[model samples]
Target: MTLADTLKGMIGLDPTAHADADMKAVLAALKELNPKPIEECSVAEAREQPTPADAVRKLMTQAGHAARLPLEVEAVQSEDTVIPGAAGSNPARIYRPAGDGPFPLILYFHGGGWVIADLDVYDATPRSIAAQSNAIVVSAHYRQAPEHKLPAAHEDAFAAWRWIVESAASLGGDPSRIAVMGESAGANLAINVAIHARDSGLRAPLHQALIYPVASNNIVSISYEENRSAKPLNKKMMLWFVQNVINDEGDLKSPLIDVVSADLSNLPPTVVVTAGIDPLRSDGEKLAEKLRDAGVAVEHRNYQGATHEFFGMAPVVQAARDAQTFVSLAQRQAFGGVPLEEAP
Candidate 1:
């Protein structure tokens, strides 16, 4: 048998017993690709690693299905702009649903462990959010690590958030109804943005939706140990990302990075989404609880059979679809719209 077949057999008679069927299938496909561990690969090589969305797209195409493209919402138009930043300017993409008046705004951050992925790699997420929530989604393309390093991306994220808040009205967005949303590293930035807003005496985001955020600097947590070998985002990859992003281990203690230990009070209402098989699952769970303890209105959901990056694979992963729906409903309610049913 081939190596993948051998590995699949080793998992158990039914590999899907512990994971969603689609998640298992995607992991199998990823194994077939045999990507090198991020720690052992150059940044360029690591960038080639198959994302969950990539795995799903490949599987669909191999099965004679059309490739799933970013959803196009009717009346929604996207535009590219350069926002003034600490460093000259930052590139951003804005998605606005078709409407005459201002709409709720979401300042979105894309995840790549703060290193590799770019705005294009995460286009589907903001597009989906904009379409589903009928809101404006402004996705920032922040400077990456090993090139710009920590505090750089954080500065960019906050600057973008500040700029959007000030320019919301000009862009057809309602500043009063703005929110922050992101996945993984982006989620970290989203939370930080909310924290910064609150501390700076700026109007905080109405809500924050974090999908499997990297909340803690500690990598030895229970979920980290349990999902050390998880596909898409293994512990080693997480470490590699940390190494590239931070100047030294001392930087880990910074509140901007170690969000779990940061002051969480006075932040906006929050929704924390975690995947069962993701190494960062515990981080999200713990952050939600801490937020609640700090008197922040919080909602937490953990999808039992999903993996890291599953939130962006909605075209094939049912859990992703459900998670997106959950986020959209949360955004709608936060924006003063009718709420849909909560996620199952």
Candidate 2:
């Protein structure tokens, strides 16, 4: 088996056939670049207040161009669904989905290095996932960094999750069938939510879907060194984002920011998706290993050729579709046993 194929076998998960060409191409491309180690990267910077509207506009514009997937999923938009949040901040958002009878819900955190993302910009992608998984997807608008640091995003994540658990019924969702999902920095938040749920005495999600997650700000993993300059989500951008998100070195060491070394014993079933060409690939792999070692039911998928943020590019890539299928199946299997599955 090729290296990617070998890794899949090691984890007891299957590789999607669509990733074949992409994986091969990416591996070849990386060999040509001869990337530097993650340690060579600089520390992430602190966040600062700027006109965020311009940043949001640019990202949404890029997403619009990036979104080539046809609108095949039925969807609805919601605004300002409140959740108890940290001091002076009440997290809220827009939700989207199809079907009416208590669907599985996804409490989604958006990626913008944890400093720039917003609901309106990421609405379509969550809407797609919700439709594909038949889940009610809530796009959480959390406190951005530079102003809010490590614990702030973690706090908002927990609050939103609690809100979903308590108010799932009103949103036409089954409280027992919720999942937490995100990409890049948001993926880190989703993983944090899962960890917190298991440790905080709160209701745990049925599943956790992490798309090219950032499990550490350290960037010491093999993939980080190998794909430091990988397009879309590079190591520099990652370091910059982390620097902005953490309050200081101590905060950087917090379990919420450093998931790789964090205790994984209580996390729920998880599906971690990585791109063969992405720097964060090793983060996802290592997390899956840690979770499995901790006796959690975890599945890892590495899509070749696709690159970072492939999950959001479902509009044009077959790999993204296959991933959605895999996650949907996993979500159903996880919730199938809950007593609430039979509730009204």
Candidate 3:
């Protein structure tokens, strides 16, 4: 039989079956937490549900991979601090490189649909960014929706960005070479922060890495249909998130919320990452296209067989490891714009 025929014979012919085995394994482990469906749960209940980070740790520990990690992974130092915002303050974690002296600074934002998740739930990605790029990463949590509502997270993100720009130097970071990185809803905030920096004449980010951003409002796109029931994130869950964040239809027209329709010119070099099995795949892809059209330098990487939240599952998923490496290399290039050899 042909290769395709043999593969079909072994694992059936369902398109959904094309998902990575490791990704499915993590999803299975996530299901073990018995989370109520997002559309069916209260905001508090949704926040209490098992996060993708939990699933990654669960799968690794269960498979006996936790004990195999290199001890050097602990070299990076992490400390908790508070980022002062207009309304109040948000908790932030700063990760410093092992062998560092004024390293490049990266301000990271966590994805939770602007309704759930936090810095702790997103610990892996920022730590991985620090370990791989040897840069200082400050991952901060913004206010969520239904309680704080729309623009609250965005306001907090800007506050965090401004704080990072003003304080990175004092924190042993090279403020001249700063970057922004985020996943899902947080990606939405990262790009907007870069824009706000340009408008405010603040120190602009040198680069931005957005993973599976919520760029376009077109939730009926192909990925939504293809992965309508995707685990961790889906069309139904997105609708739930939207309702919680937006007070009304007018909120949808805000340039901060309507990212795809906003001006994207003169932004920093960007890296947009998309997962093949994710509902936000088209969102990232479309954002990348918009950046290119606006004369911005952009690189888009679509990880086939990977799902949303896979970027933080490096310990249990190969694709996650590869994605981490890709982002780290991209961030390093933006930091120095130097080639691999003949330099420090």
lDDT at position 56, candidate 3: 75
Q: Poorest 10 consecutive residues of model 1 by lDDT?
A: 7-16
Query: lDDT for each of the candidates?
Result: 0.85, 0.69, 0.86
Cα RMSD to the true fold for all candidates = 5.1, 7.9, 4.6
**TM per candidate:** 0.90, 0.76, 0.92
Off by over 4 Å in 3: 1-16, 64-67, 70-72, 337-344
Per-residue lDDT over 36-100 for candidate 2, one digit per residue giving the tens place of the 0 to 100 score: 33334332322222212222223334533333444546445556656676555555674656446
Ranking by TM-score: 3, 1, 2
Error of 1 at 62 (Å): 3.6
**Residue pairs whose backbone atoms clash in candidate 3:** none
Give the TM-score (vs. native) of candidate 1. Answer: 0.90
Q: Which lDDT tens digits does candidate 3 get at residues 113-159? A: 99999889999889888978889999989899999998899989999
Candidate 2 global TM-score:
0.76
Candidate 1 lDDT, tens digit per residue, 226-298?
Answer: 6777777778889999999999889999988889899999998899999988789989999999899999988
For candidate 3, report its TM-score: 0.92
lDDT winner among the candidates? 3
Question: How does residue 65 of candidate 1 score in lDDT?
Answer: 39
Q: Candidate 1 regions off by >4 Å? A: 1-17, 64-75, 340-344
Q: Model 2 Cα displacement at 12 (Å)?
A: 34
Q: Candidate 3 local accuracy as lDDT?
A: 0.86
